[model samples]
Target: MTKAAGPSRRSERSRVAILRAALELCREQGFGGVTIEKIAARAGVGKPTIYRWWSSKHAVILDAFMEHIATELSFPETGDHLEDLRGWLHSVARVLAESSMGPLIAGVVGAAQYDPALAAEFHQRVYLPTRQTTIARIRRIQDEGRLPDLSPDTLADLITGPIWFRLLVAGDPPGPDYVDTVLAAVASQRFPASAGGEALQ
Candidate 1:
């Protein structure tokens, strides 16, 4: 049993080392420059070791990138759901504006245009979980009659589209007022001044 445990632990350690090395390499050199050979060399493992766990270097990079983001991201609940949603939006904007993950995410977005497998894997592994969670939250608000009767998908797009636009299209930093403006635009159809003011509480 101890002999079996020894190899299992070593494999786990090597997996972590490879992911850490991959993230650093991708950040330093970008995805085009990252390769399995380089990651294995940096991780102190052979190419076969990496291939044993992941099908390709891109898979390894995706896992590493997703892992880092998951650790840093969260949706805090303050029991007031609307306030919580606003806070969640603020937190997301802050992450993109303040973290190194932003460029990495942009790289993946660009890469996905040319790589279908990477796009699918990224959507399944990274995007869908966050999207689904946010949608469920929005559905709850809709049920409360505080929001217009939009589908959760549309609601999510309304909330996230501007944030993505600022990052990807305009290259503008997410200013402090951006979240408020977005919230107000969505809230105006029903709640009016309460969204940007104090009446909601």
Candidate 2:
């Protein structure tokens, strides 16, 4: 006899359904419209099922938002570290500029200002992983003597800060050449050394 799928599979399905529902609702009605009850109804699950997994609507929204950006969060592998970084930044800026998730992200950022718990959760779940991964790659670039002897954290900020400024403060969407321009600016400061062939660590 074939073995049946276990409870873990069911749990996984339920979790995916909940998150998918959350994303759909947030897209249709914005983050403010998402509620545990609505998500449960859309996912055809009980409210208790969502409560079992997440602490609140804010937490659920953050998880759903993380799921939405999962693909974009990976470090690209394009042979050149600066090129890879530029590509990732362009991809992220495009997402923030064109996608519906952009508004959701902005709303979350605003909400996080007043909600310390949400801010903590965002740092823990979203910011830290991406930052650490990018910083690790930057450290590898620094070790190869391509980049300056800057801290990895500082490098990450330098890379992402302008993108966020364009997205939030400047209110101007990054043009296609934005990444190339940024790369040029960084490359201008490149240390004179053999700084290639370094893979992500």
Candidate 3:
């Protein structure tokens, strides 16, 4: 059992090293350009070790990149759900504004065309949390009678879609002005026109 533990510990160390190396390489070279040989050399591990763990270089980089983001943005649980949703979007926009991050997401999207499983994973891991939280915010708004009682998912889309459409299709940065504009439009349009300043029936 002691002997078996030695290789097991080595495996954990090797795994971390590979993940770190893959992130650096993908940041510099883009995920499409990253290679297992490069990752292995950078991590100071054998190429077989990388191959042993990940089926493809993309898989290695995907795990590495996702881990990097997860560490940065924990799912913040402010009791004020609206504030949480807005803050989450703002923070997401800011994080991706970093030099390598934009490219990393782009690489994932570009690769998604050829990789069906990866596309699904991207939606699961990337889209759902961010999006679902906004849905929850919309739900709270409805509960307070601030919205038209639509489903949270649909309300979130109504509120957030324009922002995403402009950024994703127009290839523009998500400006602060645009975030506020999206929120304003959603708030006014969805509400029935009287709840203190402006809310529901």
> Cα lDDT of all candidates, in order?
0.79, 0.77, 0.72
Clashes counted in candidate 1 amount to 0
Tens digits of lDDT, candidate 1, 65-171: 87776655677777777777888887778777865667777777788888898888888877888888888788778788767765667677777889988888787
TM-score of each: 0.85, 0.80, 0.76
Error of 1 at 154 (Å): 1.0
Best by lDDT: 1
Which should have the higher TM-score, number 1 or number 2? 1
**Candidate 1 structure lDDT:** 0.79
TM-score of candidate 3 against the unseen true structure: 0.76
After superposition, which runs of candidate 1 have C-alpha atoms over 4 Å from their true positions? 1-5, 190-201
Ranking the candidates on TM-score from highest down gives: 1, 2, 3
Give stretches of model 3 more than 4 Å off. 1-9, 191-201
Candidate number of the best TM-score = 1
> Among all windows of ten consecutive residues in candidate 2, which has the lowest summed lDDT?
192-201
Candidate 1, clashing residue pairs? none
Superposition error at 181 for model 2 (Å): 1.1
